[model samples]
Target: MTNRTFMTVEEVAAELDVSKSYAYKIVKQLNEELKKLGYLTVAGRVNTNYFRKKVCYSEV
Candidate 1:
């Protein structure tokens, strides 16, 4: 229904009229949880991506 894009922690904070520190904390915690589920990771400073599913390959 919307064309908005993913937002960084600071952006979310500004949009929500909340503290940046709180946003940063929530983002950091969520990132950790995502890592545990193997659905997200950091490509660089503050870069995170979520895949729809897991992928794996094995060599015989």
Candidate 2:
């Protein structure tokens, strides 16, 4: 995977093997959660580490 601080919607879709629309929804949901936790969020991207953790992507 390329080194990136945030993942775009396309990247999220590709990584999760889901459609772009679904990826957008997922990003929105995750962003909302982050906002609730008082974390700043960008509009069409998510923090890479947060995404991996939320999706349970192990580094093993």
Candidate 3:
């Protein structure tokens, strides 16, 4: 990845090797969780670190 703090739906899809539609769903779900925690979220984008943690994508 490019060391960005956030990942767009496109980037998420590429990273997960999933379809863009599916990636949008994932982003929406994770954003909901973040909202519950009192964090503001951006539509069509997610925090990269949170994404890695949620999906169990350990650093290599």
Candidate 4:
């Protein structure tokens, strides 16, 4: 029930077609790799928001 774009571990796993256990592992690893600022976690949870390039091209 949060308005954040970030998804939970189980949600991400479903999106990636993986098991919850694996999802947990992946999220943990991502956390280590990201080491991002404003990292919000509750009671040891795996959370992440994938990043992407935003290309802006104007038609001439």
Name the best candidate (by lDDT): 3
RMSD of 3: 2.0
**Model 1, 1-60: lDDT tens per residue?**
122334476654664568988767656765676678675544221332221111112121
TM-score of each predicted structure versus truth: 0.52, 0.92, 0.92, 0.53
Choose 1 or 4, whichever is better by lDDT.
Answer: 4
Q: Model 3: per-residue lDDT, tens digit, 1-60?
A: 899989999999999999999999999999999999999999999999899999888562
Model 1 TM-score (2 dp)? 0.52
Error of 1 at 60 (Å): 36
lDDT score for candidate 3 against the true structure: 0.94
Compared with the true structure, all predictions reach lDDT values of 0.48, 0.94, 0.94, 0.53
lDDT by residue for model 4 (1-60), tens: 353555577765776688988877766766655466556544224443331111122221
Question: How many angstroms is residue 15 displaced in model 4 relative to the true structure, after the best TM-score fit?
Answer: 0.5
- Top-down lDDT ranking: 3, 2, 4, 1
Q: What does each candidate score in C-alpha RMSD? A: 9.9, 2.0, 2.0, 7.1
Which is the winner by TM-score between candidate 1 and candidate 4?
4
Off by over 4 Å in 1: 1-5, 43-60
Q: What range of 10 consecutive residues in model 2 has the weakest lDDT sum?
A: 51-60
Per-residue lDDT tens digits of candidate 2, residues 4-28?
A: 8899999999999999999999999
